[model samples]
Target: MPPPSPSPSGRLQWADVPPPLRARLETTLGAPVTEAVTPSGGFGHQLAAALRLAGGRRVFVKAAPDDEPLTAANLHEAAALDALPPYAPAPDLLGVHRTAGWTAVVIAHLDGPDPDLSPASGDVEQTWALLDSLTAAPAPASYVAAVSAAPSAAGLLHGWKELRDDPPDDLAPAARSHLPRLAELEAAWPALATGDRVVHGDLRADNMVRDHDRGVTFVDWAHATTGPACVDAASLAPQLVLTGHAPADVARLLLDHPATAGSPDTTTAFLAALTGHWHRNARRPAPPGAPGLRDYQHRAAAAGLALLNHRLS
Candidate 1:
């Protein structure tokens, strides 16, 4: 059965909830929830709440009647934990509530701040080590069929081509010049396939948290899949720069890491993936504090080229 909801003192007490759902959540929690407050910020869904239980336990509750995006994220995380080597650090999963058009999970609140990718945090070295460990204990090959497949060169090229037909006016010159090369790189797809490994498709700074002595723990598994580890690493190249990792150092390290070679090659398809990423972001409604799309377009494209060039060099 679902874990008893918060107690009288720990019930869901959000000011925003309708009277019916509020009462229902309290009944479900088996306690009068003391307080219910919306979390500060998140990307996927808006109606997220951080419930503080009577015993001082905290859990994230995502209210999306559409589909529990946060719940899906946590499920992915649980799967990744199971797939990772027994020794890897991961969040302690309490349980999940999946009914009432909402998904909530009680998880240990990580004490540390969101990870900073800058050299100050030694993110470059830490990331390298993490990637190395990930590749060392890769998921079974059969998982290839179990998870979503990486974008094929053709698929990636098609995505890039679509972007050209709808190019954002503010695109950087450097990125604009390299759009056509993406298709040429797709031609090399036959050589890029690899045996499956558990990959964290989105390993950005915001999704990872590091403890002083325990190393780093990754979160946000919504994009986790069975793919080559290199693809995972490639996905983070832009994020690394965004987080403060020196691009030059990141390039050097990936080039030296033998494990990275096991991932998809530095192909035009990868570049296309990068371009496509920014192109999509460009279309989103800009929220406050959000950077301009042109910035991401330039950065993503540059990072993609830089990563590929570093690999070749």
Candidate 2:
């Protein structure tokens, strides 16, 4: 999917780099960058690009300003990439660079475009394969468990309760009518999220790249967490809908998967919780430096609500 519109805190071009940080990066690479191309997808980084050195070597770099609020997220991604299991489909971490005013990760450049998740795309199956490989491995011991992370499902999935306490004027009529039951259903997330497998936590289209030889390589690990393996597969349901899959078809596809079998109730509840979560956030004021986030959340909320409605009916 084409990334949501650029945000004020969106990516910085190659020329925007400060002199000191640029020098440090070149030193670490052992050569001066001959070319820098800003990557098209992703919203989290202030600086994201593919850098080519004089001798034909290339690396992917993602960075954030030290004073920017997302510096912690960048650092966490570096740690998560370093901690991934050997079999996981992800870029190799070359190095991490931290200075007084910047934090960046250098990764082996993968040669492929982001997967096209739209309906009828063959890339869907490739993405499924990627998720299979990812969840088959146990979470790295060095990384924090999903429940302990900042965006833990246990923490963010309580949107129905929050909405019940302070309903937004723009809340959908269908959602508003089901508030009480939704709140009750959302309360089960903590139990549902408990599992031995590690979840990508944030498994959207923009976070995936399709390599001809490697199948798919997942990127942006700031939200990596240990939780129900099914959560990652389940998380893709709404994304499928967003990309033109019928909600009912998406539900059936997920239900047939081994990862999601025998847990229809939990899956429905999780979808409902996600619906409320995105809806609530979509109505709030945009965070500093993230002007396009609310719109993206709104679109995501609508997709989740559509799937939830299909499951509920």
Candidate models: Cα lDDT each: 0.54, 0.76
The C-alpha local distance difference test score for the whole of candidate 1 amounts to 0.54
Clashing residue pairs for model 2 = 146-226
Error of 1 at 170 (Å): 3.6
- Model 1: per-residue Cα lDDT at residue 42: 31
Highest lDDT model number? 2
The 10 consecutive residues of candidate 1 with the worst lDDT sum are 3-12
TM-score of each: 0.72, 0.88
lDDT of 2 by residue, 107-130 (tens): 888878888898889988877766
User: For model 2, where is the 10-residue window of minimal lDDT?
Assistant: 1-10
Give the Å error, residue 249, model 2.
0.6
Q: Which digits, one per residue and each the tens of the lDDT, describe model 1 over residues 138-175?
A: 68644444344334332332334555656677655554
Q: Which residue pairs collide in model 1, if any?
A: 5-29, 6-29, 7-31, 7-32, 8-31, 8-32, 10-33, 11-32, 11-33, 118-244
RMSD of each: 6.5, 4.3
Q: Quickly count the clashes in candidate 2.
A: 1
